[model samples]
Target chain A: MNAELPRRAWLRQNAAAVAGLVFGGAATAATRRAASPHRLVWQIDPKKCVQCGRCMTNCVLVPSAVKCVHNFDQCGYCRLCFGYFDPGATELTTAAENQMCPTGAIRRRFIEPPYYEYSIVEDLCTGCGKCVKGCTTFGNGSLQLQILHHRCVQCNECAIARRCPAQAIHRVPVEHAYRMKSQAASVTATWRHKEDGPAHA
Target chain B: MPKRSRIWAWSWTLVVAASVLVASGVQRFPKPDFRSGYTVPQYTPPAVERTAAREWLDVGLLTGGLVLAGYFALARRSRRGLWILSVASLVWFGLVRKGCVCPVGSIQNVVLGLVSPADGIPWTVAGIFLLPLVAALVVGRVFCAGVCPLGAIQDLVIFRWRPLPLWLRQFLGMIPPTYLAFAVANVAVGAGFWICRYDPFVGLFRRSGPAGLIALGWILLLIGTVVPRPYCRFLCPYGVLLGWCSQLSRRHLTISPDQCIQCRLCEESCPFDAIRVPTPPHPDRAAARRRMVYALVLAPAWVVLGAVAGWAAADPLAAKVHPDCALAAELRTEESTGKKEQSWETRVFRASGRPLEQAEEADRDARRRLRRAWAWAGAWVGGVFAVRRIALGRRSELADYVPDRGQCLSCGRCFAYCPREYVRLGELDGIRGQP
Candidate 1:
């Protein structure tokens, strides 16, 4: 009986060792397979974006990956820019009521009479797309929402992309990092012409 | 009173008075009017840019820390080295890194990766998640000894070494598995990482987060000072996995480098109560057999009860996990009441131009998934409890005191207390020539 007990114990120990080896090997293999270098990162396309405010709330991160990127060339430097002032604004001023951005991300500076230059405060921009919607709707889409690559942790599957109404977000090559709108030369030219009309007429 | 004590008392008083003065000075000037002509300055906060290089550097640091931990715990057998390493890890991983992409929270990422392969995981994240477990398999939980920032922070504050009753310890021990299951279920159902969301230390590491989370972090730190790694031992879902790996570790840290001399000197040395005392031979084999059989019979019953309870609570839990379900419900109530006012989420949904039925269907789908997940979670918890009960009931005789395999953190605290270890290190001369 004593001999049988030792034999049973030894058998049990060996069996456990074998089980551990098998499971550990399988786990290692699975992890290696799952961790492939050929992985796609999620990105937002500025042109396709609808600016539905989902990017801010739907992102897994507290601060969303999306941020407003300004194309200085595309901006017409208009005093009454639709992106900065609310559509229903009583006056073209930097009042809280007149601001289109909920977080006051857009900063306006007076350049000359009837002309103002606007810059985006990236920190305050919640990537809510409120200002982007305003810009796209009534003005040249100069202020567009793009995935700030530096802020993006680059999740394999973006939470916001899944919820995007426009389905604007898609995987892009790391080399072709950002999907920026081409400088809206036509829109800028037209806006400049409209401003010139008041001066010359 | 001692001179030092008096000096300390005076210093504290001065500090408190200074703080009070500062606080009073900062009181809000009662706004003269609701809309004052105060134009807020337009300034940009410094942007913290995350680069691929930085992520790789973090991974490299993690790997180096693990290697150092293994060496200190297993080869060097130096408790001081472990302490130094712990402090370094606390600074680098906790304060410097702000506790993101941590191994503790990486479990969710690994799960998400496996279940939803379409949403791939970063290589660094996978490495961070698996490296510690692999290390545990080879050399026990060296990660817990000094590499884990969470454990390091708690280890530093541990002043009291009081041991809880075995029954209480066993009961509380079940919480980690439950937490693990809950976190997995939340992730599986597409709810954001709840573990990372509620990490007690992250807020402190960042120096700022939600006020409620910061308060919770402070409270946990206070408890940790007395309880000795209350979070790691009782609540860390990741620790449960590490414990399992450590159990099957090929080579683990031993209290004595040579052999235990049965001196009983190291009994009260471990603050975490990871030491196991020798057990006498069983007197009644028949009673033990009967108890084992009884546990086996009752296991299924326990599982069923747990499942039923989970199913009953599924509705509330489901509402919490389903992203838009709760909001949609609230929107329904508002609509019924003829209220035009709507929350941002509801307004966004309305503006999306998607059919209301689609939103309702999505909510229903999420609820159904959550219900299934909760049921599984409950069963998992119940099974864990049953297994723990069964394991506790089974016992074998031991000749000497030894570190409990599952609970031992390889912290090297017990190593110093073991006289045999001192003899091995050549610090103490043995009466007989060393073997």
Candidate 2:
């Protein structure tokens, strides 16, 4: 009887592990069967966004935690990015007080002539209509929150879908969840320069 | 009567069936096995509609049933008119509003937001404090006996009539006050509400959230099976607050000596230990008066001293990564005008401030000393208040046990434990049936 006790304890512990394994296998099978095309909620047509601040406000989250991410290669290195400053700009100061939008969504980086790399700090983004509207109105749709698929809860039927006005958001195949645009030829040349030739090209 | 029993049995069967279905629902729509996948709550504003009905039911029943049971017990000891009034008030405040000032949810919210400051005060807290106060003043601590959400949960469980070791309960009780102090200080600093973050049972009832918290809930629920509502007893700040309020509350759960069947039944039945026999050879008026004076003088002083001591004691830790500490760092950072300060304050503040500055190490030493002095002062104040309570006279000789809502997390054990209430309301009234 004493000898049997150890065996019984082992079974008790392993029972959960075994059940988990079985359940996991079944869940995986179900997931495969349930899989429909993958979808991306956020997309940036950097050229189209007018920086109107619509995305900042209309979003459900309080802080709107979504901010613009810049793909340097895709950028035109424009001197006046709608993403950065208001059209009626007086001075190009980096101080938060002097920004186009009320909240400072744009972070400017100095690179070369007439071209500065700009990025969005997301947590501060209120999803107000200003930035998105601005970007869509002026420059390339460079600024948009692509609903970072990983961050999304992936509710089987998206909640935001019912509310989206433009209906610009669509479900893309999961395998190609995000569609990142390659830079223009000139920008591509710059990108390849370092990789192919001079170390710091 | 037979029909009532039949109805009860049928309802119980249905409840069991529903519980089984709901529990199994987790199994059917098998969530992703990935540790992070289905379990972890990604950062998102919690949606109100997302709250599952089962969870809401559990929360409502737990808070409602226990308070109701306590009321019934206490009512038996009081005048019939007083009892009726108390019951009506309880129904209006506790059950009608669904235990809004539910100590359980409020305490949990406070804990959850402690690390994150942006969170707002949950509405349920307003209900928990207000309902009980209104009830106690008008009807007496009927909320404490039968209607409080947390008390209901505890009363419903705690099956074995074993006495917890005094030293053990005392040691455990210390945790809630410390938690209370931590919550109050953090809230004052605009740090994330500490009360809501780590609530074990709220997570359990909700059935989904961040994996870490959900796991903690399950552990607590399992613990509840053996130890009663451990969170309500040990770590709830709201319970601590209510316990104090109940102490001062005029319309308390009073037992009449005329009903004198000194059966000791109520004493044994009460899980909260609110009921106690009056100690013999009570202190004379002079002694009582002296004690009351001491209580009045020492209580506020102790609170201040305790606050200071607690603050000073934990300053070094608080200075780092505390949300409030971040505010101070921001101030110092601006004062330096980008110039590096080598002071001790700089070091303590550096870690908390945004856009980390390397020179602020100097501020740490001075800050630590000041905070320590403050903490010592606070401890003395708090220590005195605790002492004065012992000196004060006992009001109720035999009372029904219900958790203090200020510290309780509204877990459903008390409601489960009150057998008489369970019989009256049926098990579904106490149990959060599946589905």
Candidate 3:
């Protein structure tokens, strides 16, 4: 029983120390939470994106968070796509020289003799904006870059956002994460058509 | 053929057959044929994305694990509870999470964030990195006890306890600090995440990645069967930070619940050899003081030497950080040899219409940053070594066996072995009862 006295004292001392540590930890956690903006996460607006290729290099992750997303509704289903074919292509073949994407991310398929369909092979896309730039310049802006939310760790201040020349990236509600141009354009078109009809009458 | 030679020959044949089986199993999917007209293969990208909800779940698991580890190690003192927690952590963190956003690899992220404020870190990453460290400072290395998947995997595989030689262990212990220094320096200069790149077990968890790393993981596990957390002890750069926190921990794991009877029954219970035996009184205090003074005097010189070494290696280290630097060098070589072909990276650089001088300028800038960072890292490494040497040289008096606070993982293995603890838990009667 005599040996227990010092041990109990030690325990009491340690308990106080533990209490202090817990209090300190709680205070720090509280302050960090207060300092951070918690509810929102960064996303890229497809229409606003100029495809400057900053997303490829400026992202903190080795593979950038920005990936090419196909909006089939916006696509014209052209036989010769600006996004798929090289400007100086000799033949409309699936040859390496005829491809526009530096990584061959755009895959071309033959639907019939004179028609073909194009889709983005995401794994190969480097977010270089080369294909997006081509498509936006010549064809309907069907192929666009979007932040793959799954790949994004949602940094408090995104690295790519800071470097984006067009200021395309912005924080959006998690519930409405994706900011696709096709959906926005269609909504605007219907509103425009209704406004035009009233004006004509 | 001799019996041994014949056996070796049969084993080689069996290994070849096993490799073929494994390869065939891995490639069970039908190969795509481009020649038979273009049929667009439905590309199903691997679902390895982190959602906000999933990130929260990981954070929740980490926080819960820390609390449970502390309770098991300190309050309950249940080795069984710790074992269960370890296994659960292995499944959750190792297998389910697939070893990404781990505390071990997060050290690089935190370092990178600190160095380059532009590369802002995720709050979740920051929280995951700091949580265990704060926990360690309060409750010793309870994080290592059952919370860390790396430590848990190693702890589970431990069967035969074979302690390394004192000199060898001490020498190997120095590796973590050096590793920590290099990882920080590399990241500070925008070098790739070396820790994640070389993670031995991540490949095993994902069941894909480079084969060489998988082989290394298996080898490490094989060694861990006897060595008891070889990575945690000798390699993990994060452990260096944890050890420092544990050293100043408020309330660490104790071998006895009530009193140390000095029975020494729990002496060999620790698989990691973290138990400190009772030390005799210092023979000569004056001599010890002189030795400490000498060590203090030599510490600066050691720092300078380390700085010089780091500065010298800065050029090579800088090359690793900027891909453009390596590409430029390769392009120059190809140009001098009159080779018309250009690599993909060089082609991309040229196609971008950026001046070659710009790439050179970036390389130079990266090298300058690397030199400064490497020098500081070297000095830090030197300081660590000096402190370690002094710590080793110093002698302390101990009345009873206690867990070495810095080295002890707070695993609670010794608690079950302690007679006093057994009695306190009512597992043993006070008089003439076998514990």
True contacts kept of each: 0.05, 0.00, 0.02
Model 1 spans > 4 angstroms off: A1-67, A73-76, A86-115, A121-137, A144-201, B1-53, B432-435
Off-target runs (Cα >4 Å) in candidate 2 are: A1-201, B1-129, B140-157, B254-258, B282-308, B319-321, B324-377, B392-435
DockQ of 3: 0.04
Residue-level lDDT for A161 in candidate 1? 75
Candidate 1: residue pairs that collide: none
Estimate, for each residue in B1-435, the C-alpha lDDT of model 1 and write its tens digit.
999999999999987886564333321111122143433233232233555678788889988988899899889999999999999999998877767778898888777655554334567777788778878877888899888998998898888868888988998999999999988887888766778877888767766555777798788889987778988999999998889878767678888786777778889999889988888867898998899898888899878877777677778766566675766686677779877436656665676777778878888888888778878888888888888878877866666777887899989999878877877877788854233
Q: Which candidate's TM-score is highest?
A: 1
Clashes in model 3: which pairs? none
lDDT (tens digit, per residue) of candidate 3 on A30-126: 3343223233457777766777788898775557878887765556556667788889989989898998988888887666656566888877888
Interface RMSD over true interface Cα atoms for each candidate: 15.5, 24.9, 13.8
Greater TM-score among 1 and 2 belongs to: 1
Residues B1-435 of candidate 3 have per-residue lDDT tens digits of 899999999999987886564333222112233454655433232343555788888998899999999999988889999999999998988877768778888777666555443333567777788888878877989999888988887888889886678899888998989988987787777665778767788767766545787799889999999989999999999888788778767777899987788887988899998988887767888998899899989999889988998988888755555554676676677678877336545555666677778878877887887888889999999989898889877876567788887899998889878888868878788663332
Q: So what's the TM-score on candidate 1? A: 0.77
TM-score against native, each model? 0.77, 0.42, 0.71
Ranking by DockQ: 1, 3, 2
Kindly provide the TM-score obtained by chain B of candidate 2 when compared with the true chain B.
Answer: 0.51
